[model samples]
Target: MTTAVAAPFRFFSLQVVRTRRLGPSLARVTFAGPDLHAFHSDGRDQSLSLFLPHPGQPEPAVPVELGWESPRSGEAGSGGGWWQAWRELPDDVRAVMRSYTLRALRTGEDGHTTEIDIDFVLHGVEPGSPVQAGPAARWAAGAAPGDRVVMLGPAVADNRAIRFRPPADTDLVVIWGDETAVPAACAAVESLPAGTRARVWLEVPHAEDVQDLHTAAEAEVTWLVKGAAAGPEATLATLRAAELPPTTHPYVWIAGESGRVKRLRRHFVGERGIDRRRVTFVGYWRQGLTEEQLREQG
Candidate 1:
């Protein structure tokens, strides 16, 4: 007899209740919603689509409601509530969509108010980048108790076609990531079995970029400072040179800029001879595209 596999849950939206600076260039936004109750916390590395309103708009219309059972096709929902507000947004304002990770999730006693955290990487003083350091940054930078923004995401986790279930006796793991993927990489490291030998390579712009991370496994971390040549391609070369135990079963995860991730994926699976299943490669962001744009390109 054959058992049927359950269908994966679809994505949904949340309301940003607050936002704050986690570090110099990292902004943490906290979101809440009923849908979060169904979110799979074990899939921490997954990407989420975030919908932000036009700068001056007071209230934004809501898009379609998403859930485990929601049908895949439909016009944006028609209610005059949050959903309507989003539907009526001006074309220019409607165009602003960003992608971020589900950094962490907290389920309360009643499972009603799930707090989801997302970190936005501030890219200098530019205006167009998500979480820029300009005027809009002030909004996110100083967001307080009552401020709110529309959020839609926690898209299904990227389960690579090649799977590697680390053996019970496996000794080591290696994780490499850029700022865009720090949350996911950190979460993966934290979830590993206790006493598992692990090494984490993180590439960030500044010294303050190194936050106090929480992880359960024994981890030796290396931080790559993007000083002179801060491009993603340059950083990957630096990280690849760092050595790991060749004999140990190393489950490697590398994620970040698209170009760099693509190159590393080729090098590891093609040249280095590591089984494709042993490595998870994700392109968290591309050089010149927004999160939504990145999705469209993919």
Candidate 2:
């Protein structure tokens, strides 16, 4: 018999409190749950597994109370009425689940009500695309004030943590990412030592995706457009090839689509011979996988 490991944490039910449009393809959904009291505040780019009920299903089951068993068990204690039916579902036809980042977090006065923000990338009508005009996107775009969903995972350890405490003599720092990786880049920038010299590169599908970021370090910012001839790797290569001040320390951070990020990581750590410990590289998302799938693969 397989022994089940108790989930390190429990999931909470949250209602869609609000929604905001960040871009033509990005929408932010805010949810408030009582379980937020246990959330680790420093988690950014961390993923949460969202359990969305099937269309027309009366309600969703609570993962914690039901344990980490598959939701296919039917509504909790509804009798084995639908349990056997749910168990008969094909592996691929099960209810949909998606992973998304914790873009922002806020705590209520009593610390019981916590609001968290997550962005969903709208993939325009592409068949098989995770964000295609399907049930999940429809649910997110039209989530009602009282509609409930299950939130699992803060997945704290999954993030690539970077701690940068450069020596006083250090000089230059470079950070770059595609829009999906922006949260991590922002977190890294905010954590850098005061007065550090840095350059930031952000790539997005359109000009409007750019947002002003505040940081204490001395820095120059650049925005690159997707589909432009100068891809992220080329852009980073150009910057890396430039002459630098002798005392500048190079702390490089690059993340985004898997292919592009892998290329940049190789160039910086292999060809350029930078110290491995001095660079932080993360593959935030891949070109063609849902965030949940990525987490499973990892």
Top candidate by lDDT:
1
Write one digit per residue (lDDT tens) for candidate 2, span 1-298: 9997434434667778888866655677888766667555455345456767666764454334444334554233223433334334554444455655566777678754378877665555334544447456777766667777877654233333323334455578877778777655666576565687878877776677666677788877777767445565576576567554444357777777878877877777888777777776777667777655675575
lDDT to native, each model: 0.63, 0.63
TM-score of each: 0.76, 0.70
Q: Model 2: which residue pairs collide?
A: 171-248, 171-249, 172-249
RMSD of 1: 5.5
* Candidate 1 ranges beyond 4 A from true positions: 1-13, 65-90, 93-95, 110-113, 126-139, 154-170
Best by TM-score: 1
Error of 2 at 88 (Å): 8.2
Per-residue alpha-carbon lDDT of model 1 for 1-298, expressed as tens digits?
Answer: 9998534434455566777776666788887766676555354575655555556665344444433232333222223444445446676666255556667777778753378887877666334544445333445565555455655443333432112245565677777788888877776676677788887888877787787877677889887767645785576576567677654466777888878888877777786677777877877677776654654464
Model 2 spans > 4 angstroms off: 1-8, 58-62, 66-95, 110-113, 125-138, 155-173, 190-194, 228-249, 290-298
lDDT of 1: 0.63
Q: Backbone clash tally for model 1?
A: 7
Candidate RMSDs in Å, in order, are 5.5, 7.1
